[model samples]
Target: MLKTYSVSLAVGILAGLIYAVLDVNSPAPPIIALVGLLGMQIGEHLIPLVKRLINRQPVNLHWFRHDYHHKIGDNPPPSGDKTS
Candidate 1:
């Protein structure tokens, strides 16, 4: 998770730095607009996918955690085993 956010931040900063050299009339706007639209369209589903990959979690990208947020309600307390 940390690595994913770090890479994302680094890429965003690098992209911003590169684009800062360009004028407003540049074609960067359309590409950025498309990326932003795609991000907004699929960001929530994407981040958890990235996090699962980063953590080596044994779950698919479109699993219940990311695609379905609340299908399972609050879990009941465990038995008196007192496990962590």
Candidate 2:
């Protein structure tokens, strides 16, 4: 997560620098677009959890944690799983 945010910040800074060098007005639409995209992503993940909460069902967090670990390469591959 930190890495993702750091990369985004770096890209934003680079984009701002480019705009400054080009003497072009920075567009507001792209700023809002990224925010909207982030909101959609958050909603996509959270909506299911919210629905489960409303129905008094247990939220299975195993997959979520598994995926996070997988992304960070912190989880080991399955034992004896031969991948040629």
Which 10-residue span in candidate 1 carries the lowest summed lDDT? 75-84
Once fitted onto the true fold, the runs of candidate 2 whose alpha carbons sit more than 4 angstroms away are 1-28, 63-84
> 1-84 in candidate 1: lDDT tens per residue?
999999989977765676667534334668786885587558756776688779997674335544344433544433453223
Instruction: State the local distance difference test value for candidate 1.
Output: 0.61
Best by lDDT: 2
Q: For candidate 2, lDDT tens digit of each residue in 7-77? A: 88997887778667867566746876587568757876677668767999765555445333344455654
- lDDT against the true structure, per candidate, is 0.61, 0.65
Estimated TM-score for each candidate: 0.32, 0.37
- Model 2 scores a C-alpha lDDT of 0.65
